[model samples]
Target: MLFYTVMKPLVQVALRVFFRQLEVRNPKRLQVPGPLLIVGNHPNTLMDPLVVAVNRRDPIAFLAKSTFFQNPILKAIMESGNSIPIYRRQDVETGAEKLTPEQLAAQNEAIFGRCYDYFDRRGTIMIFPEGTSVQERRLRPLKTGAARIALGAEARRNFQMGLQILPLGINYFDPQRFRSDAFLNPGPTIRVADYADLYRQDPEAAADALTEEIRQRLEVRLVITRDAAEDELSQQVERTFGSHLNPDDDPTTLYDNFQLSRTVQQGILYFEQHAPARLAEVREQLSAYLSELRQLGLTDEALESGRQRPGTRLSRAAKATLRLVLGFPVYLYGAINNYLPYKLPSMVARRATKDAEFVAPIMLVTGMLTFSLAYVLQTMLVHHFTQDWRWTTLYALSLAPTGFYALSYWNNLETRVHRLRALRLFRREPARTAGLLRQRGHILQLLGEARAAYLAARTAQRA
Candidate 1:
């Protein structure tokens, strides 16, 4: 656990840099005492554990696949960080064969015993019940491993351990993107003592019941899409028009946006059931509208820009230009000093993995190495040249803050550039510009009508 203590603060800082917004709904759930088990949806590989672990007070023990222990360096790291490995069938199967019933029991019993001992110390453990990571909104069917572990650990002490299972929904706005938002929605604890009677009767049945309970709690907390097409439409609506719908969206926490996303998914399902034709029309039109914007080198924001009042528009333009001018020197300094470290990680990640879930962790691990080494090497060179420790320390300190500033500056600059493109298009092709604006307005009208109809149907059904 010495390794965990040393790395916890560093991981906390790294997470803050990686994600733009990390909001936790009902944060008090995390402060609950240990002998606790954290169960969460696995959307990003190694990122899932770090995101949950960094938020809590004490160290969390994780269950990793036995394959990770094959590598010498990773084995040492995992051991020091209090990780236990369990064999997976996919890793063991040599051909197109499968494991027999409860095939992993023999292999996992020792691992389970390790967990029972951990709970004896009143420690916390985290597990992904889904067993594997997949980068999608939909939660996969959970294995009974987490449920069984909780029950076993409790029974090892004859149900007097006071153990609790914490179910968490890890909601990601965009799993693969670099500065996307992540929301942690935690469910209430499931007391292990509540199942003591059932477990004593039939252990297997008790495990199944506990797993179903976990599934229910996690379902309510997550925004699960039915299929790929549904996911696509919901994301499109949320990205472009969500704010208009949830105008009073809470600025402090992302729970409001989470609610909006869940509502949007329900709306999609409702339309598909009640008026498939209308839904299809909307989908087609939305696709066409987006295609037109792409061909015209514009975004939804650009069309919205055309509607701004002249005085407000000019003031906004002047302010954007001033920000660009004033922030240029800092941006340049950060780019020159930090660009190599940032770019190398992404390049390495892309080359290393084809799986969507693996991308984030590879980039994260690669970044941890690249940035640490680059900063130390660069700082030494600066010290050698300056012969002044104070100046060198100051330069070292400025690297991270300026790096973050550079990122923000570049993102805002892109927004300004897109708006300017809209202005230029209006001046150069007035007829085409007006046509696109009409198309956009029509799409919004269609969406508004559909929402009204859905609400009416929903109200009438309730009545």
Candidate 2:
């Protein structure tokens, strides 16, 4: 299949290169003898699925959106990759939506009949209970699809061989980043006996209960925190939980004196499902624990400050645009440059003072020599591979404009860094601990301005 041949290799290579700190706990909890259901949160669309498929031993058939089936080529790819198309309400035929209870029942029977067949053959299926992706820390109200499907399968077989639903949480540190931290936590399997009857009584309620159980497990396994105010803790709870939380009423402290309410802990679990490395969950826990420790005047100031939020100087729009248009290129360049050797010394000379005379000629010559050598080696490789003079020439020629532009951008960034460093040194700002907490509003504003400028330059370049 194309998945094992092409897609899997690409995914493996990409994952190996981009993800770090991949700690998978209780991996054996994923194994089940009969049909299995894997339910978890959805973050990055393809990335999450890819991560799961690449890491998981089971051959999982996912219920994907119907739109992927629109294109014949894409549909083929999905089918080849073991994905099933599920028509969302909007995508279904108009007459189908207005069907009576009996009609709806028949339709459900047909759709689930296919799922039952897959399970009968002893296969694994994946579903996103949240139904959609949310970038925030908290989980959206979950849908009952996973629970309903599991219950349906059990009912069909008279619970002869019950479906084992596995709860998995993927934690990410800067998920959007090219190279980041990802951790996979596999919790205990939810048995058919756990909520099968509940599903028959009230399927929706059963789904909620199942999701809550998994959510609770995730919270206990993942929260990290340090000292902060009650209001700050409350805000964090609201942001991470997406539920109204009151820190004042029976305040939940973390760890020792910190009592975290069951609801708050559930919120923490849901947050763990949002990002890998359980950073947000851990951050909140750490905040609560440290806050309590601070009240007792026992928290370490140095560690507390280190645990605070990272400041972003850029605006949101600019940051978003930068993440796409600039982030990848910057990351690639950094990766390549780190691997490439340079003639320059690693440590700067101790005698080199801030007021020392500039050395532009030396810098320019060094850059030129490096570029020339790199270009020569690239040309030779292309020539050897293609074995066509014209093809090699074309490939070499194509680099001119791109290389020029990249060099200019790199030089500009280099100059800016130098200037900022000079200013910092001149002002005698503290080296390790400096600056106030960054505001999200300011970051968004800066991003907006930068994006506008980039657009202007692009428009001018096109003209």
What would the per-residue lDDT of candidate 2 be over residues 151-206, giving only the tens digit for each residue?
77877787676678887775554554433456666677888656767877887787
Of candidate 2, the 10-residue stretch with the lowest lDDT total is 345-354
Off by over 4 Å in 1: 95-104, 456-463
Cα lDDT of model 1 overall?
A: 0.88
lDDT of 1 by residue, 276-353 (tens): 998898898888888888887778997798678879989999998998999999999998999999899889988999
Candidate 2: RMSD to truth: 18.6
lDDT of 2: 0.55
Task: Tell me the TM-score of each prediction against the true structure.
Answer: 0.94, 0.52
Provide C-alpha RMSD values for all models, in order. Answer: 2.3, 18.6
Alpha carbon lDDT of residue 147, candidate 1?
93
lDDT score for residue 402 of model 2: 54
